[model samples]
Target: MTEESDSPMTDTDSTTTGPLVPEDITADSPFTLPGFFAALAEGRLVAARCTECDTHLLPPRPACYGCGSRAVTLSEQPRTGEVISYTSVNRPPSAFDHLAPITVAVVELDSSARLTGRVDASLEDVTIGDRVELQVRDPETVDIDPDFGLSYEEEWPIHVFELI
Candidate 1:
């Protein structure tokens, strides 16, 4: 991986070649929720925060389960966390029909909130309580986009370590 300088550029005379934005991932039914897609569009991981307890909840719900607060705020989450549990899916459901046996892990964020995502690393290297990061790989660069309606580009990979 190469590091690029984070310099602000003027709109009129900028000469930096930034990363290419990849196509958004889409899904049918519940996965197509507006809030869910909005987070990814802005390159942020959004979760619901409880107004009463100030607790962050992943896979955000309309109301906080902890305090039953309807006044919830959708906020970005840190990219680092520790693996609480995980499992490899040799036979995924129909929705994940296109992905080869992928490993999924339940990660506990620094805030103690847990969210599940694909583990990009090898299965042998993954373990409970291991440090893991969130990686957003572009499907286009990899030339492998599943036909399940989700699209991604390969050249612009966004990987963030939430825990280590």
Candidate 2:
């Protein structure tokens, strides 16, 4: 087989732009969640873009799910997006009871990458097509219970959205 092929299984082109081996996927690489969150904490949103298919992978991985290609590269994502769908969670898990009636939305960013996150608005205030901007918060700033599966040392960044 050559470098290019129409069949997904036969597409063996190695556009491998980023890490190509396990030893290269360090915490400093955006290909991992730790690295992804690290960038978020620094006020930057990053994703993996497949060179072969233009698929954007949030919380980036090494391979492209779209064309089964391993030629993914780090990409900075946009903070603004529109609300594609939303809902209110009146009954949340016990650990998140303090945040009852949480409003969540699946936002499609300007790059067409979609991610689900809490919206800093009441259910009644949010609607389809509403413009919003991403907000990254230190986990401690939020009222999540300590036992919410995250340890103090591993304080993860919380992603949310606010109407623009």
Best by TM-score: 2
Q: What is the C-alpha lDDT profile of model 2 across 1-164, one tens digit per residue?
A: 12322212111223456578889889877788778888889988887888888887887888888898888877777788889999999999887788889999999887777799999999999999888889998888888876775553365689999998
TM-score of 1: 0.62
- Quick one: best lDDT, which candidate? 2
Report clashes for each candidate as comma-separated counts: 14, 0
Residues forming the 10-long window of minimal summed lDDT in candidate 2: 1-10
Tens-digit lDDT track of model 1 for 79-125: 66778887788877665556657678888766556777778765777
Question: Quick one: how many clashes does candidate 2 have?
Answer: 0
Off by over 4 Å in 1: 1-32, 94-98, 139-147, 150-164
TM-score attained by model 2: 0.87
